[model samples]
Target: MIYRKDRKVLKRVDFGAAKNSLMGVLAALVVYALVIAWGRVYEAFQLETLLVGGAVVVVTAFRLWLVARFDALYGAGPARWRKLFAFGLILHALVWGLLPAWLVWRVGTGFNFFVVILYNVGVTTALGSSWMAGLKVRQFYILLMFLPVIGALFLGGGLREWLLALLVAAYTFYLFRLYRGQYELFWHAVTRERRSGGAERRRELPASTDIQLSLVYRLAHELRTPMNSVMGMMSLLEDTRLDDEQKEYLQVAGQSGKLMITLIDDVLDYSRILTGRITLSPDYFDLRGAMEQILEAFGPMAQAKGLELAAVVDRLLPKRVRGDRDRLMQVLTNLLSNAIKFSERGEVRMDVDFTAEGEHDGVLRVRVSDQGAGMDTDTLKHLFEDQFLDGAVDAFAVRHTGFGLLVCKGLIEAMGGAIGAESVEGEGSTFWFTVRLGMQADMSESSKLSGAMADIQGVVVGAGAGSLACLQEEFEALGSQCQGARDYDHALQALRAGHREQAEFDLLLVDTHGRRELALNLCRNVLEDPSLRPVKLMLMCTIEERGEPTVQRLVDKHGLVTLVRPVHRTGLRIALGRLLGVPRSQPVQDLPTETPEERRRRKLYRLLLVEDNEVNQLVTRGMLSKLGYQVKTVNNAETALALLDQENFDLVLMDCMMPDLDGFAATRDLREREQREQRPRTPVIAITANTAEGAQARCLAAGMDDFLAKPVHLQELETVLRRWLSREDDSAAEEPDSE
Candidate 1:
C-alpha cells in the first residue's frame, strides 16, 4: 500500500514535471557527448574533470527535482515554473562548461557513433520534456526535437552530410524565425495573464469576484454623479426667473444627464454578459417596431456627429417575430454603432431583407455597411477574438475591445442566427446577420408599404440652456413640444410628478455640466421604475472625463440615446423629429444616399488651422485645402488667439499636441483670457494624432472644447466642425459680453 501510494504521488508529479525532466535529460546527454569528444581528443580523464562532470549531472538532477517539488507544493504556478527553468539553464551552462571533450573523444573512439546517438537522445529528451509541459506543447516539442537531428546531420563528415547541412541550415533559419514569432506570442500571453490574472482552479472565484465588486462600486458611484447633475439641472429648469437662454442651457444639462444614465446601463449589461450571467428573455414582439426603436436610439448620435444614418426594411417581411427583443435590438445597435464609428466621409447603410423559405416561411436578414476604414481578411478573421485590441500597438488606429462583435455573435447565435462580414481593405466592409423566425402569413401583406409608420413623441429637455436653445427652437418649430429643465432636481421632480399630474413627456434630454450626475440618476430612477417605463431618455455630453466602460454601460442598459456635446441644430432637429414621430418638413437627403463627392463637400468646414512647423503647416494646408475646407492658417497659439479675437471662425483648430506653448497650456490661457475679458468661448478643437497617454483628458480639462486625432481624416474634421461650429455660435453668442 505504501509503495502504491508513493507511486501514485510520483505519477502525479511526473505528469506535472514530465516536460522539464525530459529537457534536463536531453541537456545532460548533450553535455555527455561533449565530454566524450573532449576525452577522446585530449586522452586525459583527470579526477578534477570527473568531479566537474559529476557535478554537472548532479546539478541537472537537482534542478529537475526542485522543479517537480515546487510544482507539487505550489500547484505549478507560472512564476514557479520560470524560476525552476532558470535554474535548469544554469545547470546546462555548468555541464557544458565543465565537460572533458578530450577524454570523451579518446574513450569513445573519435566521433563514436554510440556516444553521438546517446547524446542526441538525451538532449532531445530534455528539450522535449520542457516543451511537453507547456499548454500547446506537442507542435513546439516536435519542432525542437527535430532541431538537433538536423544539426547533427549538418555537422556529420561526408558529401551526404554536407548536402544535409545545407538543408538543415535553411530549416534552422526558418525555425529560428518561427521561434521568434512563438516567443512573441508567449510573451503576449504571459503579460495578458499577469494583467487579467490566470485561468485555472481559482480563476473565476478571486479575479472575477474582484472585478464584480469593483464594477458594482464603480457603477454606484458613477451613476450617482450623473444622476445628481440631471436633478440639479431639472431644478434650475423650474426656476421661472431664468431667461430663455439660461433655461436652454439647463435643458442641455438635463439631456446630458439622461444620456449618462443610458450609458451606465449599457456598461452594466455588458459586464453581466462578460461574467456569463446575462439571461436572455425571449418574447414575441414586433420586429419592425424593435428596429424603429433602435434607429431612434442611435439617431441622435449619428446626427450629432454629422453622419447620415438610415434604416431600410423590405416590405415583404412580417412585422412581428418571436425572439428576444432586447438581444436582437442589441445586435442591430452594435452593428450600426460600428458602422457609424468607422465611417468618416460616407454614409452607413442598414438594410433589412427577407429570404423566402420553402413555401411561405422566411428568414430576416439585416445588413449594415459602411464606407469607412475597412479591414483586411487577416483583421476580419481575428475581429471577434478576445484581447484583440491589445494587438493594436498603433495609437492612431481605432480601438476596439472586441467585446461588441463577440456579444453580437453570441446574441445572434442564441437567437438562432448567423453573422458574418465581407470587406475590402481601405474601401469598406459590410456585416450581415440572419435571424430565423416563424413569419406571420397574415402580417406579410401589410409589409408592402414603403416604410413602417412609427408613432414617436418628441420630448426635448434642457430647452432653457443657451447652448441648446437653437436645438429646442428647431424641435418646436418642427411641431414637437419641447420640455425645458434647468437642473437635475427639477427634472426628477418633473419626471416623478408628470405621470401623476397628467403631464407626460415621451423623451427626456439633459446637458452634461453641473447637472450631469442628476441627469444620470434621473435616468436610473425612471428606467428602474415600472410606472415610468414607457418614456425614452436621451443624454448629451462631452466624453472628456468619462471612460469607455462608463459610456458602454449606459448605452447597454437603458436604451439611452447619446448626443456628443456641441450638436448642430439640424442634427438635433432631425433626431428629435425621427424619435418623436414628427415628420421632417425639410426632406434632407440621407447620408447613405449621398455620393462620395457630395459627402466630401458636405463634410467641409472653415478650420482655424494652427501649426508651428513650416513643413507640417504646408502639408496640412495642402491636405485640408484638397479636401475642400476653408483653412485659416496660424503659426502659433498667439496668432490663433489674435485671430479668434478678431474673427468668427467656424472652429478654432488648435495644435494642442504641439511644442513650446503646448496645446493644453494654450487652451488654458485661451479659456482664462476669454473668461477674464468676457469674450465668447470659441470651440478650440485639438488637432493631434498623439496617443501619448492622457493627452485627451488633459486637452479637455484644460478647457479645449474638442479633439480630433492627428493624420486627421477630412471626414473626421468635417464631422467635428459641423457639430462644434453649430453649438459654438449658440453658446458664443449667449455670453453676456457678446450682447
Candidate 2:
C-alpha cells in the first residue's frame, strides 16, 4: 500500500514501526556482550561457549546493520519497507529469544544458569512491548520470542526447573492480558494527541466538486471494472447447474462481491454527504422486505465469522414506506458491518422503533447493537467527527468504522433525522439513527420525473461546423433552447439578448473554431461580463489550440470545461453535468400519457441491448432472455441505433460509453430522430459501468428513462423490468394501521 498525502496517520504508523528498532538492536548487543563476558569462565565448555558467543556476535552485527538501514528505506515505499521491517523483526526475535535458552540449557544448575534464564525472560519481556505487538499480541515476533523460551523451560526435568517454568508460563499469560490494556491505552493516547494537535489540521476534501470527481474517477476506473467482471461472472454462473458445495462457493463469492460494491458505494456516498450533494431517490419500498434482504445477505457473513446475527422490528414499525430505500439500507448495512467487524463471536442485533406523526408520515429509529469490544468516552465523543479518524480505542477493529459512521450521520441528518452512539468500553456498543419519512406510497402513484430543469438556455458559437448541428440538436432534444452564432460578437449578442429574461443561460459552448485569437478574446469578454458569470462556459478547441499557451491559461485561470474539437455528446454531458449539474428531466405534465396497462401488456417485448464489452452483452442477454423477452445485442450505440430504425423494439438497454457514438449521444440521436419523424419515444434505459457522480443526471438529460450500474443483479434486473416494462405497480402500500 502506498502512503497517500492526506492519510497522515499512515506516516505516524510507519514512524512507530521505524522507531525503537535501534533499542531492539541495543538489547541484542547486550546479549552478545553477556555471551563474551561469561563464555570464557567455563574452561571445560570452551569450544561450545565460543561458538555460542561468536554466533550471538554475528547475529548482533546483522541486527545493527538492519537498525541502521531500516528507517531510511521507509521513504523508498511503504510495502517494501514494511516487508523489510517484518523480516528484520522476525530475525532479531528468533535469534535473541533462543540464545539465552540455549546457553542456559548448555550450563544447567548454576548462578550463570540463572543469569541466562533471566536474559531469556528479559528478551521475552522486550517482545511483549514491541511495535508489532501493539497491532496484535499474537503477532509473528511474539510467537518467535515466547514459544521457544517457554518450551525450553518446561523441557527441564528437575522440580525446581518445573516451578521456574511454571512461573514463566504465568508471566506469559500476564503479558497477553497486559497487552490488551496497552493496546487500548496506545490508541487512546494516539486519539487524544491527534485531537489536541491536529484539531484544525483534519483532512477535508479541498472542494466538494473535486472530491466527488476524484472519488468517481477511482470508483469507475479502479473499482467498478473489476467488480463488473466479478459480479458478472457470478450472475452468469448462477444460471448454470452446480453441486451444493459449488453453490456454496458461488454464494460466498457473490457475497464478497456485494460487500465490495457496498464499500465502493460508501466511498462515493461519503463524498456526496460531505459535499451536501447526495440525493435521496425517495420512492415506494417495502420496509419489511428491505430488512429481510439485508439480514439474508449478511447471514452467511455472520455465520462464517461464527457470530449470531439477529434483528427485532417493533410492532409499530411500518411494513411499507415511501422513502429513499437504498440510502436507508446503506445506513443500516453500514451499522451491521461495523457491529460484525468488532464482534468476535457474540450476536449482532438490530432493533427498530417507529412513531406515527400523522396518517401519512412518521419517524423511524433503528439501533444496531453488538456484543464486542466497545469504545472509551473520549472516542465515543468524537466518533462522527473527522478528528476521530486517527481511530478509536479498538485500533484495527474500529479502523473501518470512522467515515462510515460519519456518512450515516450526514445521511440521517439530511433526511431530517439524527444519528448517535452509546458504548461502555469493555461491554459493547449500540449505533442508532432516526429519520422522519412518509408511510408506504400508494402503489398506483405514477412515475414522476423532477421538473426543475424542464427548460434551460444554451448557445453554440464556433467554427467547428462539424459539431454545431449535433450540439444544437442534442440541446433541443432535451427540451432546452439552443441558438447558434456566426462569430464572437454574435455569440456575445446572443447571450446578452437572453440575459434579462434568462438571468443566466444554463451553458455556453464556445468552439475555438480554428480561430484562436478571436476565440480567446471572446472568452475574455464573456468572463469579464458580470451578467454572464453565472453561465457555465465550455470551451471546444483543436489539439493544438487546447495546448496553446493562451487557451491553457484561460482554462486554468477560469476553471472552464475544455474539450477537444468534435466534442461528443457523452463527454459534453459529463463536463456540463459537473458544472451545471444533472440534466433536468421533463415535467410530469409534459411526459407522454402512456398507460401502465398498455406497457404491462407488451409481454413478448422486443428489447435492444447496446454494449461494447462482449462479456457484458452475453451476461445481460442471457439474464434478460431467461425472463422470456426477445433480445437483440449490438456492440456499440451506432449499431443499436441502426437496428432500431430497421426493426421495432419495445425498449433499449443502452450502455452509456461506446465507440464514436456513446450511449448518451446515441440516445440523443434516437430522440432527435423520433421527434423529427413523429415516432413515439422508445423506453431507453441506460446500463453503464460508469459510477460518475452525475451519471444518472446525464442519462436522464440525454433522454434515458432510467439508469442501472453495471454487473447488474438478477433481482435488480427483474425489478427494473417490471418498473419500466409496464410501469410496474408492485409496491402497493399497506394500511397505515397494519404491522
Candidate 3:
C-alpha cells in the first residue's frame, strides 16, 4: 500500500514505539522485584543480603513509578518524557550490571547467591538490548551498564569467565545489527511517506467509459471554477496601466482560458446527452442577435487561422422566433467549431434562410458551410449513428467527428428539426438543420431598424479580389457607395483623379494585408496630400500591426482609426461610425458610466456566499466584492443556515457541492422554514461548476431562485443580478431608498 505521513499515521508509530520502551522497563523492574521476594522468603537477613534486597526493592519501586510517569506524560511532553524514560532504563541496567559483580566479590562464590545475582543480571541485559530499539545513544548506555560484569569476569581469571565475556560480546553485536535494521526500515517508511505526501496514493489504473465520463464532468467543473477566477481577474487587470505587449500577452492568456472552458463545456454537454438527461427549454429570442453573438464568440478562433467567419440572415426572416435559443446556439456553435477546427484557410459562413413562412409559424433553415477537409462516403454514411464515435476516436485526441457532433444531432432532433450534411471528399462540407418557430407579433420594430452607416462615399485599397468584394458588399449594405481599386498605387491615383474631378470622398478604407511598412508608406502619402486630408482614413491591419510604433503613431499621435483584419461587420461598422463622427442608426449600448443611483445600489447590495473549497471561496469572494457587493462567506451549509437565522441578507449565493448539508439541502430547509414561519422567501442563487442538463431544474426545484454556471462572466453576473435583485423583498429586509 502507498504510505502517507499524516497525523494519524505518525501518532500510531510514536505510540507503538513508546509502548515497546515502557514494556522493556517494566520487564526489568519485575525481575528485580522477584529477587527481593525470594530473599525475604528464605529468612536469610544478613547485613549484605539486607542491603542488596533493600536496594532491589527501592530500585524496583522507583522504576515502576518511572514507567507510570512516562506513560502519563509522553503524549503531551514527548521530548521531556523520552529523556526521563531513557534515564530510568540506564538506572535499571546499572543496578543489575553492578549487583552480580558485587555478589561474586562479597558472597565467596556461594552457589545460591551467584544464581540469584546472575539471573537478575541476565534478565536486565536482555531488557536493555530490547530497549535499545535503534537509538545509538541508548546502545551506548547498554554498553556502559555491561562493562562492570565484563570487568568482573576478567578479574576472576579463568577459561570459563573468558568464554562468558566472548559470548556477551557476540550477543551485543547481534542485538546491534537487529536494532540497526529496524532503524533503517522505520526511516525508509517515514522518508517515503514524507516525499509522496497524500497525493500519490490515488489509483493509477485506467477507468471505464462510465468512470471516464464521471471524471471528465468532475474535472470540467473543478477546472472551470478556478479558470473563471483567472479570466475574471485578468479582465479586472485590464483597467490598470499595462503596455501594449503586456496587454497582448494578458489577452492571449485570457483567450486560452476561454478556449479551455469552451472545451470543458462541450464535454459536459456531451456527457449530459449521453446519459439521456438533456432537455431543451424554448423561448422567444432575436434570431439575428443570437447569430451575431455566435460569430463574435468564434471571431478569435477564426482569426487565429487567418479565416473569415460570416453570418448571413435573410432580411425577410422574423426578427424574433420562439425556440430553444440556447440549444440552437449550441448546435450552431458546435458546427462552426468543427468547421474552424478542420479548416486551414478560407471563410466559414453561416446562412440563415426561411424555407416557408406564415403569420403564426415559419420554417427556418441554418446551413454552416466551411472550406475544410471533407468526409469520405463511409464516414458520411455513419455520421449520426450511435457508434460513429465509439472506437475510432481517441479519448484525448482532437476528434474530427464524435461526441460533439452526436450532441448537435441529438439537440437538433429534440427541437423537432432534421440534421444533415453535404460534402465532397477532397473539397469541403456543409451541415444544415431546419426548425419550426413562431414569429413575433410586432414586426414593425424589426422593419424600423436602419443601416448605421448611411449617406457615405468610401474607397477601398489593396485588398485581395475576394476580400475586396466582401468589403464592398458589407459597405453597400450600410448604404454607402464603396469603390475598389486594384492595388495601392491604383487607389491613390484614383483618389487624386477624384480630387481633380471634384468628387470629394467621405471615407478612405485601407487593407494592409500583412505588410506594415507598405501600409505605413501609403498612410504617409495620404496624410501628406492636402486633397485627401479631409477624407477620413481607416486601416484594416493585421493583429501584429496594432502594437507597432508606426500604427500607434498614426492612431494616437496622428488620429487615424485602425481595425483588426478578418473583421466582423459589428467591429467594422463601429470603426466606420467612429471615423465618420456619426452614431449608428440603432442605438448601440456601449459600457455606460455609472449613475449616482447605480453607485448607491451597488453599495447597498449584500450577499451571503456558501462554498466549501477555500480557494474558490477566496477568489469568488474577491470578485464579488470588487463588483461592490458586501459579501459574507461560510464554509458549509450548516454555518450558512445558522448565519441566516441570526441576520438578514439580500441574497445568498450557494454552492451545490459541499461537505455535510450541501446547498440543495440547505435551500430546501430554508424554504420549509420560510413556509412554517410565514415569512417571504429570500432569493437564493446557486453558483456551481456542474453544467449537467438538469442542474438548473434541480436547483430551482430545491427552492433556489436562480442558477449560474461556474466561471460566471462579469456581464452574466450583472445580468443575473439585474433580473433577480430588482425584486426587493421587504419581508426579508427593507429596500434601500434611491435618494
Candidate 4:
C-alpha cells in the first residue's frame, strides 16, 4: 500500500511538471503587462527612480519564470540549467542596460547611470549563483536580492546606493566563476553517461548473433537462385542450331539474369544499413519522368503477381527537384516493391506532393500507400528498428526483411526529412516519407526535362544489321543520332574516332543476336580502352540459351546495360532517356530486331578441334564434331602441347583441362614457350568448358588467348577460329600438324 502511494505521488509530480510548463508562460506574460502598467503609474506620480527599479524587478522576474517554464517542459538537466542561467544573463542585460538607458535619456536624468550599473551587477550575480542553491534557498535569495534592489534604487540616498553598487559588482564576478565551473563539471558527467549507454548497446548487439546469422543465411539463399539462373543460361548458349525463336527465349533468360543480379544487390543493400554510402548524385530530372522509368522496371513483376501498380503525382510537385536521381529511384523501387509484396489484390498508389514548409525551403513528400495486408501496431512500432524483426522466420514477411524500412528511414533522415508508416490491421498501410530539397530557381519545365535527358550517354554495339537499321529508324524518329559498328574492331574505331573528334552521341545501341561473342568482345574492348571509356554501352542480344551468362558478364564485367532481343522502340527510348538523363516522355514500343529468315540466313563456322578431358574433351569434341566441325583429339595438354610445337593447323584447339599443365597454365606455356624459343605465335583456342564465372577471362589473361566455352558448338568454334585464323591468313598461313 505504501509503495503504491509513493508511485502515485511520483506520477502526480510528473503531471504537475507538465501543467506548470504551460501555465507558467501565461503567468509570465501577464506579469510583464502588469509591470509595464505599474511603471506608468509610478511615473505619473513623479516617482522616477521607483518606477525604473520596479520595472527592472518585474521584467527580471518574468524572464526567470519563462526559463523555468522551458525547463519544466523539456526536463531539467545540467544542460537545461546552464541554458537557463545563460538566458537569465542575456535578459538582465537587455532590461538593465537598454531599457534603463532609454528611460534615463527620455527623462533627462543624469543620475540613472548608477541605477543601470547597479541593476546589471545584481542580475548577473543572481544568474551566476542560480545553480548552487537548494530550491528553498534559491527562491529566498532571489526574493531578497530583488526586493532590496527595488527598495534601495527607489528610496535610498546617494552614499548607500554607491555601497550597494560596489557590493553587487564584486558578487557578480564571483558568481560568474561559480557558474562556469559548475557547467564544466555538468558537461563531463553528460559525456560519461553517453559512453556508458553506447557500451550497453554494443553488449546487447553481440548477444543476438544467432538472429543475425539467420537473416544472413536466408538472404544468401535468395541471392544464389538468381546467380544459378545466370550460370545455367550461360551453359545453354553453346547450342549450334539455335533458331530465331530459340535465340529470343535465351534473350529473355539473359534479362532474367540481369534482373536477378539487380535484385541481389538491392537485397544485400537492404540487409546492410550502410545508408550513408548512398550519396545523392543529383541531376535535373522530371518528377513524372523519373517515376515512369521506375514504373517500367516494376511493371512486369507487378503484372506477374496480379497486382495493380499506379502512380498519382500532383502537378504541384516541382517538376524537377535537385536530388540524386538513382537514389530517388531506389527509394521508390523499395517502396513499390514492398507495397506490391504486401498487397494481396488491392492497388499500390504512389502520390507525390510539393509544398513550401519552411522559410526558403521546399519539401517533396512522396507517399506510397497500399491497400494491402496492414501490419499490427506492434509490427509498425518496430518497423525501422534494425534488429526489431531480425529473428522473424516467417518466409512470406521475412522476404521484405524489415531492412527496407530501415533504409527508407536512413535515406529520408539524410535528406533532411522524415519517414513514417501508419497501418490499421487488415485494413491497409500507408508508408510516407518527405524530402526537404532546395527548389531549382529559374528552371523552365522543358529545360528541366531536357537537362535531365541530356546527361545519359548510350553506346549500342554489334546490333545485327537488321536490328541496327531498326534502331536507327527509331533514333531518327526520336530526333537522336545513331551510329553503327559491325564488329568489335569497327565499334572500337568508331568510339575512338568519336572521342578524338569530341563528338557527343547520346545513345550507343548494339545488336548481339548472331554476334553475341563479337558484341561481348567489343564491349570488353571498349571498357578496356581508356580512350572509349566515356561511352555508356548497351548490349542488344537475341533470345538464345547463352544470353543469360553473356548478359551477366557484360553487365558485371563491363558495366554494360542490356535490352533483350526484339527491341521495343519505347523501352529503347526510355533506356536512352534514363542512360542519357532525359525525362522520359513515352514508353518505347517493342520491335523485333531480326526476322526469322534473317537470323537463319546467318553463316555458321566449323573447325578442327583438340581437347583433353575425357568427359569435357569427349563431350565437346562430339558436340562440335556432330555439329559439322572436323575435330581432332589429344589425351593431354602435353600431346596437343607437343603437337602445337610442330604443326600449322586451321586452329590448334588447345584444352585447358589437361595433365602435366592445366588448360590456363598450358596455354600460357604454349604461347610464351614459343615466344621464349623465338617461334612464331600460334593461335591456340581454349576448349575447356568450365562453367565457373570469370573462367574464360582467366584463360585469355593467361596467354593461349582465344576461348570457346566447354561443350563447344561447331558454330562457336568456327566463329573463334574464323576470327583468329582469318587474322593469321591475312598475315601468314601455317601448315596443319599430323597429331
Residue 431: error of model 3 in Å?
Answer: 4.5
Provide the TM-score for each candidate, comma-separated: 0.32, 0.47, 0.57, 0.32
- Candidate 1: residue 187 lDDT (0-100): 35
Candidates sorted by lDDT, descending order? 3, 2, 1, 4
The ten-residue window of minimal lDDT in model 1 covers 446-455
Query: What C-alpha lDDT values do all the predictions have?
Result: 0.56, 0.67, 0.68, 0.53
lDDT of 1 at 308: 51
Q: Where does model 2 exceed 4 Å of error?
A: 1-69, 72-211, 214-218, 241-245, 281-313, 316-325, 355-364, 387-402, 437-607, 625-632, 643-650, 675-682, 691-694, 718-739
Clash totals for all models, in order? 110, 0, 0, 38
Task: Count backbone clashes in candidate 4.
Answer: 38
Mind giving the per-residue lDDT tens digits that candidate 1 earns over 201-290? Answer: 455366754556354435333333324323432442343355564455446545645554444445555555556555667666888767
lDDT of 3 by residue, 447-531 (tens): 1113545677788886555456556766765666788767787778878887888887767788876355676788889987787
From the highest TM-score down, the ranking of the candidates is: 3, 2, 4, 1
Per-residue alpha-carbon lDDT of model 2 for 262-325, expressed as tens digits?
A: 7667766777776677788898777866886787677656756766565655545565787899
Candidate closest to the true structure, highest lDDT: 3
The model with the greater lDDT, 1 or 4, is: 1
What are the candidates' C-alpha RMSDs?
28.0, 31.2, 26.0, 35.5
For residues 326-358, could you state the per-residue lDDT of candidate 4 as single tens digits? 767777888888888888865566766788665
